[model samples]
Target: MMRSIFSAIIFLVLTRVVYAIDPRWGQGCTYIDRTEQIYCFGGEPFSENSQQILVYALNITGNSVLDLSEPQWTDIPGDPNGIRPSAASRFTFTGFPGTDTFYIQGGIVCTSCNYNSGFKYSVSSNQWNQTNKNKPVVDASSALVNDILYSFGGQTSPLTGYDQSNTTYRNTVYYINAKTGADGPSVKPQNETQLPPFTWASSMVYSYVYRSLFIFGGKQLSATEVTASMSDITVVSPQTGVYSKWKNIRSTSGSLPPARWGHSTIIDSSNRTVVMFGGCNDSGKAMNDLWLFNLDDAVWSPQETTGTPPTPRCRHSVVVLGKYMLVLFGGNDGTFNSDINVALDMTTWKWTNAPTNILPSDSSPPIDFPNSSSPQGSEGINEGGDSSSNISGGAIAGIVIGSIVGEDSSSLCLRNETDI
Candidate 1:
């Protein structure tokens, strides 16, 4: 009897220890150079099935995703009222010089949300602060650009539930200063910018690859009513002043992503290709077709991706880490905690056969820093033709040079999953 009791106690202790060290995907991951870490936010529950552990990586260097090592969960709670928000949305994690952390912009605390609200997270302190502004009620569209957060569409009232096929839109753009010091003076949102009533077709399906944010395709922006007549790419550059102008990239191609708002997009950095998968059609019909966008050329080319893209999903959480773009865990797709992480390898153009839960050791070649020198003392390209300003090393790391002049693909994946 004494031996059995001792053995049982040992097993229980081991189990608890392993649970504490489980590899948490977190809501999603971000870079925390100030902390000398890579931080990942937890995915939110649009419903009960959407909850997951939020995590952070402390020992990262260079551009290798492997730098994140494995993720460890932070001791944070998802209670909507909790100071450390586990769930997140359109919040921008902008880092500044002299500090090794990123500031969370505006986002909704949807741990138990029926709609949306305002909240922010701090990486250094692992804290979330309730903002002064209660966001304008909009169900589907919101994004963070620069120091401001913007919500584009969705109706606040007469809505008790969420419908991925929702087309009702507020088309109002709300902005907030995200860089305000944590304990510094109070900040105010600039004037609200409103646009024409839009269809919320893209809300359910979209990705944030590239930079300066762009929406590839979607229906009318309003809910309560749905429209499938429009399918054009709309872009909003945070750099634009006053009101960020929405530029329409009209497409003449007969091929588009089938008027979607909930499908997700992933940037294949290795190939400069945009992969979009799963969303309902304009008429409340769920779809599972996969599409690819050539951001370099501003063109959408459809691809027949294999190995089971989740069955007709919308409102799913996808993230880019290492060389694999992991697509797993989302709802309105028959089940949640689907417990599957699909790894798509860009170099091989094939999916790997492994438990999504089990990923290989992360790896990526370091940037060729020494090769960074300009051609033997010759100044690089100038504004006119004279000696140009020297481009700093940090500038080179974030620089995207190619045919793509649009959103950050990784940002698109996070934005779509931002409500998490």
Candidate 2:
């Protein structure tokens, strides 16, 4: 009898020792280097055969060290009385540099409509306050540079259909004041200056090295044709005036990744390199391939990673920590997943355990923009050289095959689930 009790106790302890993976999708997340905490806002708790989509304004934080080595997840509930942001997905959740506050921007409400409302959450106060201004709602990718939040190339509200090109894709660039989280003056360049192609679901990263924004892999759509420019790397350098210089970087060799959307791209300040991970390819397939772009050399290199890598997915959130480790969180792989809390050590190009001694010192921005601003030399031509002409305009019909159960290729909104 004593032996049976001891065996039962051992079984219970073993089960308790297993790591926990949160199940969610379409969450807005960002990492605060100062506090070493990752904040994720509203997300849809996903499951196969689940009809009801529950979006919660739950602030999920990974405290202490999210080194991928025994990382911890905590639910920091907001004040019950404070007005919370509406439950939504594909919203922009980003943090301001040098502060403990993070902002949540426009997102799609559960009923498939988009909202332009804005709210700011204070980690220190544990409260959420609505922003004073509301901008035009969009399904765009945004990045912060010098206190300004620039949203590029996303469809505006009243989402028609995911695969439709005529009214769905946008090349409009919206500039919002990061201070008040409100719309600002037009930053769009003149018709003569190079402009980025009309695209949505693409990822954009600001490079302090060149004072430019690098965009990669989103479905580029146009009327009359559905072509995608997955091979070219578009760079938009914002200048002092309204006119920003745009250029496309083509791979001199064959190491560049194919056209994909819903991928995550982040910059490594230490080396002036951009790391890109999985996204849905043009053929409606999820990829787990990893590639690195040497910003200095203007070269693309495929990373040969070892150890257990995360499963193939898109719409996942990633943040670089310890200056070398890239930590990844929730995403979708045919189905929604919250169990992915992994890291890639860029130094060794290996998928190894997080080093306990390596605590990130620099206050890296929420989106992995390098901490330094030293000018790295440029390779492409200047302002007047329009790169938009290089884009082979056309949209691909049925570009994304829904991997989630009960979802078909024709389902809009949820098909391109947004992430940070």
Q: How many residue pairs clash in each candidate?
A: 49, 9
Q: Which tens-of-lDDT digit does each residue in 1-420 have in candidate 2? A: 563454344333322222434555556665543344455665554333223322222112233333454544545545656666656666665766557677776655544333546778776566778775454344467775545666666664543212222344455455656568666654324332444456777777655445455666677754532324545566654553222323334454564577678777765533256677887776656777887766655556777888877777777666544534443444554575444666666655677544433444434222222222333344332322221211011100000100000001110011121222
lDDT of 2: 0.51
- TM per candidate: 0.54, 0.70
* Residue range with the least summed lDDT across 10 consecutive positions in model 2: 396-405
TM-score (C-alpha, index-matched) for candidate 1 = 0.54
Candidate 1 C-alpha error for residue 67, in Å: 17
What TM-score number comes out for model 2?
0.70
Query: lDDT tens string, model 1, 15-130?
Result: 22211222221133343334433344443443354544444333332333331123222333334445543245333233332343344432344544333333455544445565
Give the root-mean-square deviation of each candidate in angstroms: 11.3, 12.2
Error of 1 at 296 (Å): 5.7
The residue pairs in collision within model 2 are 22-338, 225-394, 226-394, 226-395, 227-394, 227-395, 230-259, 334-403, 334-404
> For each candidate, what is the lDDT?
0.37, 0.51
